[model samples]
Target: MPSSHLRAAFVLLLLLLSGCEQEAQAPLDQQLYIWQRQWRPAHAEALADSRADFSTLRVLAAQAHPGAGWSRIQVDRELLAADGRPLVAVVRLDGQLPDLDLQRTRADILALVDHWRVQGIVMQGLEIDHDCASARLLGYRDFLRDLRRALPADLRLSITALPAWLDSPVLADLLRQVDASVLQVHAVSAPENGLFDPARAQAWAKRWNDASDRPFLLALPAYGIALVNGRVESESPLAIAGPRRELQADPQQLAELLANLRRDRPEHLTGVIWFRLPLPGDRRAWRLSTLQAVARGEPLHADIRPDIQQSGPLHEFALANLGNLDGPLPERIELPARSCDAADALAGYRLERAADRLVFTRLNEGRLAAGQQRALGWARCEHLDQGGSRVYP
Candidate 1:
């Protein structure tokens, strides 16, 4: 009717549409990377446990190195399909190689995809996990173009991007070749600097979002690694020998970061891909329960305490983790005892006897998975106050 009334109605309509668009935006998708070289029987349990929280599994299917040539992981098909989630097979190429044998590489990946399809595993995408240097990005782009052309029309293509490539001018061209990119923000640099830094990772995600037009995911660390005499051990059993340091990606730190990302996410940032899937006995990785809590943005805590089983004057000491998060064993534990006859510590700890107390000092850093226990030592005393024991970080 009136021009003033028409203007007021138009402004209200615009505001309503904007609110609707914001409400329609979905929460960030969560994915997991199964980087374990071998698939064990425990993987079935892991997959079943993780099926609810994680939407997809990006599995390491095969790898090719300069001198090593090619190697493939024998993935358990039943375990892969048990959860009925989306799957993405990843082919790793050694970044040190001067040039790639494009023909063989292409053939191996296609054959793998074909075999999986025949086995009834529907692959959502094929990812190229190559940590190529910024200078070699041009060559990498060419390889991705070749591989993308050979892949099936329905299959999506993606690449594992490194934050180190942010400085390269050709980064955009590489992103153009893939449907998506996973920016790995953990363990890309030296181990001495630590496995992950939340602030630095957020900054990198922002920069990557600005550079790439396609949707991208951030690969965050969900595990710890041991540095032994300048060597990094990821999947191997950590040896106590030589100078060693344990570096873990804390769940609380990651949870905080995820909350910030949720509050103010980048435009092209689609989701996050947690580094390796956690298994029951994998000492280096986080427990599935704890990881799930982190994905849901729940608070993290570890309730590690000294456990004592007594039989008369004999007392067996152990550390028990009762909380949801797996964490490092405490540096020291002190217990009050009287008239102690004998005592000794376990392999990773040393026992110190005082007049009124016995202390167990850690000799090397170790992790106690949630709901797990490790025997620390034993003590024989006339009267041991097990309830009075204390653990120190």
Candidate 2:
């Protein structure tokens, strides 16, 4: 083809691509926000501070369900303190509603709402994260819809959602009926168990944002690493074991993650909720410095530190052997650390044979503040014929 004709065709193709991109983007009028679980105790305090700059907040309620805790609602009258100020109240809906009276439950939630209103309190919203197959999902949706219809028109509603459900054909229908003040997309996938992928998380967010006009919030993990027999096991909260490693996330990686969210689906990008508040004994997770950066919507550019700490000879040897485990052991060993900072502040230590396996415990005095230290424990394992050891607790 002639040069002029080829150039004209290229220009036309570029224009067509640009038009398609514009059409695919969601409208800018949509609002964005975050839904924090009650697990983060400082949630209300955090919101009260400058960190609460987001457009909305979704509070998880407490409750018990059938079979196991599917998701139930608990109403607290003290949601607003006696002085008439907002107090962070959470109602858990983990298990199925007990065989209790339905009327009582409804009345309870209404009473809690009334109490909050009288104190001039503004609720964030509600959060529920059960499997889609559970009857709890349907019941919860109906309950929310009914509650929304009955409550003041200004009140907001929100819920926790898994990626799998976001992709379901029924999700659009289900969401349409609920009074969704915000939809929090939780990335609690068991990736090692082949249940979730991080990419799927991004896709799920885009899918929901594409399907509905409701605002969306993304929940990021705030736990530490779990090592066994020399291999990094999993990042799931349930699988975590051993002393928490101080893994500082690189600012750059975080920036990339946030950038991907913005590029793939900007409209749904309401805000982010760091999975947890500050906890003690979690050395191998993102630090407050990193979280503050995320809260600011600034670009992240730091590297994630490995979970194991290397201070002295014994500790270094113990860490090396722990990372090279071959099989499971009989008894689980516990190496206790006083606090998160205490674990980080260690200068050096060494590991030696403790019966069948080796053990190295850091002896430090410094400790994290009261609300910081959750707990810590470690296990010991025996080596296999191939000269490798394994430990699981």
Candidate 3:
């Protein structure tokens, strides 16, 4: 038998080897898409994941603003051809309808659509949103009619219905012209912030299901919301600085939410599409681990805080900034075991304040965003403030 010291050294070596193997086996969070400008790196890494199944992977090429025209757009012909066929492209017609001359925009959009069609790509849908007014509705309807005439029979058309538009009597008639419709239940407009009500989202989805024969895709916000010094704005490279606090739901919570949504209304549900894939080197508020977990059929856990006054079936949570602004500031925070609830578990990070410097613990070191909300999977903070160190559970 080996001596005690020798046995101990052998055990240590074995543990170290095991750790190295785990590090090697850990999945690289490299999923990418061009929607958020993270196509190349993700493609490179995904090609390396031999265990990953890409059969169900659907590529979407979305054009959010057609009024700006398609001149500035760079279409990647190589990426567009996965196995030598065109990918599904969703063209978004956003902004005030008045700013859009439907006839001209339609012509522009149709030109691009035809170009892609000839390349053998599937133009899955034309996503549009308009205010609920008699003239606007009629004008939009007319545009759809012309667009439909222009599209090949196999091409699909879809529209986004604001909550108010869904309430309108014309919704049923309007949906008849399209193949699919997406209900943008969550409101992101200024003055009305973080208005994501899961119950309300479900209700709106149900209404669409009962009213229209068209299939629908429910758009959910993959990132959480935070008030950057009490200001809520759209996230972009040039927009307002990063979020003041991160408020993302955990992956398990997201899984539960999806599972619940599937259980409550499976017929209306098609599939979940995370808003804009995370950009390469983006350390902001996105849970890549959670996304991977969901994709791989793993259980996800979330830290949710409940709203007492809400009577809806869905649960809600909020993440807030805990440190003071005037002083040196608490550079880290540790959330104790009972800090979260069943619905809104702490799944991500909130960039609550804009600081010149910020540091993260082992799990979050390379993942935390300096000026944005970041969703957490298995990470925490250390050496916060001038006080004690805090660890996020």
State each model's CA lDDT, in order. Answer: 0.89, 0.44, 0.49
> Regarding TM-score, does 1 or 3 come out ahead?
1
Q: Which of candidates 2 and 3 is the stronger one according to lDDT?
A: 3
Candidate 1 residue-wise lDDT at 316: 93
| The best candidate in terms of lDDT | 1
Residue-by-residue lDDT tens digits, candidate 3, 1-393: 569989999999999999977754543222222254334646544333412522222244444444454431445555455433224455555554345576776777777777766766554444554443544676677777788888777766766666566666667777788877666655534433444666666677777788777777665554555556566533543356664654553444445565566446546455454554544454343544445555455654343221112223322222222211101112344332211212222433333222321222232322332222333222222211322324443
The residue pairs found clashing in candidate 1 are: none
Instruction: Rank all candidate structures by their lDDT, best first, as comma-separated numbers.
Output: 1, 3, 2
Candidate 1: RMSD over Cα atoms?
Answer: 4.0
Q: Please give, for residues 41-86, the per-residue lDDT of candidate 1 as tens digits.
A: 8888888888889999999989988888888888888777777888
Q: How much does each candidate deviate from the true structure in C-alpha RMSD?
A: 4.0, 12.9, 18.0
lDDT of 2 by residue, 1-393 (tens): 999999999999999999988866533221122223233444344444423333333334445456653343333334323223322334444433454344555566667677666765556443434444433455656665675676566555455565555545556656765444233333344423332245555666677778777666666553344434334533334454555333323334444566676566547456555555443233444444445555555554422111332333212222211121111121222333221211221233233333434333344322222122212223222221213333232
Candidate 3 weakest ten by summed lDDT:
320-329
Each prediction's TM-score versus the true structure? 0.84, 0.51, 0.59
Point out the higher-scoring one by lDDT: 1 or 2: 1
TM-score result, candidate 1: 0.84
Q: 362 in model 1: Cα distance from truth in Å? A: 6.1
